[model samples]
Target chain A: MTVSIKITSPLTNADVEKLRAGDKVLITGVLYTARDAAHKRLIELLDKEGIALSAGKLPFDIKGQIIYYVGPTPAKPGQVIGSAGPTTSGRMDAYSPRLLDLGLKGMIGKGARSKDVLEAMKRNKAVYFAAVGGAAALIARAIKKAEVIAYEDLGPEAIRRLEVENFPAIVVNDAVGGDLFVQGVEKYRGTGND
Target chain B: MRKVSVKDITAKVKELCIAAACHLEPDAAAAIRVASEKEASPLGREVLAQIIKNFEIADAENVPMCQDTGISVFFVEAGRGVELDGSLEDAINEGVRQGYKDGYLRKSVCDPLKRTNTGDNTPAIIHTRMVEGDKVKIKFAPKGAGSENMSRLKMLKPSEGVPGIKGFVVEAVREAGGNPCPPIIVGVGIGGDFEQSAILAKKALLRPVGGKNLDGDVAGLEEELLKTINGLGIGPMGFGGTVTALAVHIETYPCHIASLPVAVNIQCHADRHKEAVI
Candidate 1:
C-alpha cells in the first residue's frame, strides 16, 4: 500500500525504517541535501570514527536524518534554491554504507542503490526513497525553505537543509529487504502475466 | 574562409545545444509512444507515459528535459570547402556556456580532479569529421550523467565473436538496472580499438531508432543483440518487462586482426538529441 507522512524538523531514524519499497510517500519535514562531494566528506568524517565528531571536526549530526542526493542549478534573484532534483544514487554507493552504519536513516534520491547499500539499509532498518528525477521545478516547489547547512565550498552540490511539505517519493527499499524496483519490475514485467 | 565570428559560432552552437536538450528526436519520441502501447505491464506503461509527458513539459515550458542536463557533446561533420574563420573550439565552448545559461539547464561539466563545477558548461567533447560538400553538420546530444555513467567498453578476444559482444552488452545493462533509466536505447560500437570503440559507441547513438545498420552483417548482429538485451527482463525502469530496450544501434569499422573491441553506450528513454546541417 502507498503511504505518505508529515515530518517535522529533524527526522528520526525510527521514522525512516517504517518506509519500504513500493510504498508511495508524501514527506513533510526538514531533510538535508548532499551529493558526491559532500557524501565523500561525510564518509571521511565517519572513517575518522568518534575522533572527528568528538572534537567538533564534523559539520552536522547524521543520526535520524534524511539526505537528498542532488546538485541543483543556480537560483535566480529572490529564489531560495534553483531546480533541485536527485542525482544518480549509485555514484554514492561507496559512501552510503558508511553513512548507514553511522545511524543515518532515510535517503531521498533517484535511481537504484548498490547491493551493499541495500544490505546496509536492511541491517540498519533504513529506507531509500526516490523523487522523480528531472522534475526539478515541480519538486522544488515542495521545498518551503532552503539553506546551506554545510559544505558551501562545494557550490550547488553543497549540503543543505530543506524544509519540504508534501514532497513526493516512492520507497525503493525497506528494512525487511523488499526492493520496490525489483518488485515493481517483476510485477510489471511483460511475461504471460501483466 | 567563411569568416564566421565567435558570435556567429556561439549562436549556432547554442541553437544546437538548446534544440538537443529541449526536444526529443523523432525516432526516440516515436519509440516512447510505441512503448506506451506495446507495454503489457501497467506500471511499465505508466512510466513510459511519464517519460512522454516529460518531453512535452520540457518542450512546452522551455525547461530542460532532465535536471542532469548532461555534458555537452558535439559531433561535427565539416564540408570539404568549409573553413573556420573563428576559434572553432572556443566558439563551441562559448555556445555550450551560453546555451546552458540561457536555457536554464544545469552546468554538469567539471574539473575531473578538482571536482569543481565549470559553471559555464565549457570544454565540450567535440568530434569533427571532414566530409564532402560545403556544409557544417553538427549533432548535439546532451548526454545525461546517469546514462553516461552506465556506459561500458570491453576488449574481448577475437575468438569470442558475436556471443561475446552480446553477453557483454547484456551484462552491462543488467548491472546498470535502474541507474541508467530503462526502456533505454543501446548503442554498440564494434571492430575498433579501445578509444575508437568508445567513440564509435557514442557515434552510434546518432542513428535513428529502427534504422538499419549500413552493413547487413552488422544489421543482423544488431537485431540479435536487441533481442537478447530485451530478454534480460530488465523492463522499464528495471521493472521486469519485454521492452527494456527500445533499439540497439551498431556502428562498425575495420580494426587490427588481433583486437575485438566492443563498446556499449546506453541512452535512457529521454533521448534528447538533434542534428543540423548548414
Candidate 2:
C-alpha cells in the first residue's frame, strides 16, 4: 500500500523512519543540489579537515539535510531555475555512504543505488527518494528560489540551495531495508494483462 | 552542381536544436497518452499523467523538457550534386555551440578522462552519407546519458539466431529496470559489423515511435519484443505497473557469415529529436 505524505526539511530521524518504500511525498523546504563533480569536491574537503591545512569549512552543514543529484541547464531571464531533473544516482554511490554517515538524512535522485549505500541508509536512519528522471520543466516549477552556494567554477555541477514547494517524489528506499524497485518488479512480473 | 551555404545550415541546425528541446514529438506524446489509459498500476498511470503534463509545460514555457540536453548527435545525408561553401563539420559544430548557448540548453560534453566541460557543447558527433539528390537532410538527436549509458551491444554466434537476440534484448531491459526510465523506446540494430551495427541501432531511433518497419517480418519481431519486455513488469518508472516500453525499433543490414552483431540503444521518454532539409 502507498501513502501520501508531506515532509519539510531539514529532516529528522523520526521523519525518515516513518517513511516506507512506495510512499508518495511532497517535500516543501530547502534542497541542496549537487552532482558528481560537486560530490567529489565535497569529499575532498572533508578529507582536508583532518590535515589542518586551513581549508576552512563545508559550504553548508549537511546534518539532517537532503541533497538532490542534479546538474540543471542555465536559467533564462525571469526564471528561478532552468529545467532541473534528477540525474542517475548510481553515479554517486561511491560518496553516498560517507555523506549518509555524516548525518545527511535524505537523497533525491533517479535510478538504483549500490548495496553499500542502502546499508548505510539503514544504519543512519536515512531515506532515498526518486524524482522523475526526465520531467525537468515540470519539476522546475516546484522550485521557488535557487542560488549557487558553492563550487561556482563547476558550472552546472555547482551546489545550489533551492527553496521548493510541494516538490513530488517517491520513496524508493527506506530505513528498514525496504526497496520499492525490487518489490514493484516482483509484484508485476509476468502479469501481461496489458 | 547546387550549393548550400554554411550560413543556411547553421540557421537550420539552430532552429532544429531549440525545437527538439522544447517540443515533445507528436507520436511520442500520443503514445504516452495511450499508455496512461492502458496502465494497470495506479502509480504507473499517475507517472504517465505527470509525463504528459511535463510535456505540456515544456512546450508552453519554452524550456527544455529535461536538464541534460545531452551531447549533440547528427545524421547528415548530403547530395552528390551539392557543393559546400565551407567545411560542413565546422558549420555543424558552430551551430551546436550557438544553439546550446542561445537556447539555454545544458552543455554536457566533457573530456572523459580529464573531466573538463567544453562549455559550448561543440564538436558534435556527425555521421554523413552520400545520396543522389541535390538537397541535404540533417537529423539531430540530443541523447541524455541516463538512457545512453544503459545501451548494450553483443556479438552473438550466428547460430544463436533470433531467439538469442530476443533473450539478450529482454535481459538488458530487465537489468536496466528503472535506470533508463520506464516507458522507453528500444532501438535494435542487427547484422552489420560492430560499429556499423551500433550506428544502425541509433539510426533506428529516428524512426517514428510506434511506427512499424517497412518489412512485415521485422515489424512482427518488434511487436513480439515489445510484449515480452512489458511483460517483465518493469512498469512506468519501475514503480510496478504496466507499460514498461512504448516501442521497439529494429534496423538490420547484411553481415559476415560467422558473426551476428546486435546493439540496443535505449531512449528515455523525453525522446528529443528533430530534422531539417536544406
The candidate maximizing lDDT is 2
Q: How good is model 2 by TM-score?
A: 0.97
Q: Report lDDT per candidate.
A: 0.77, 0.92
* Candidate 2 backbone collisions, by pair: none
**Among all candidates shown, the one with the greatest DockQ:** 2
For candidate 2, write residues A23-131 as lDDT tens digits. 9999999999999999999889888786443323678888999999999999999999999999999999999998887889999999899999999999999999999
What are the DockQ scores of the candidates, in order?
A: 0.36, 0.68
| Runs of candidate 1 exceeding 4 Å displacement | A1-14, A45-61, A76-81, A184-194, B1-3
True contacts kept of 1: 0.29
Instruction: Give me the displacement of residue B211 in model 2, in angstroms.
Output: 1.5
List the candidate 2 regions with Cα displacement exceeding 4 Å. Answer: A1-3, A51-56
Candidate with maximal TM-score:
2
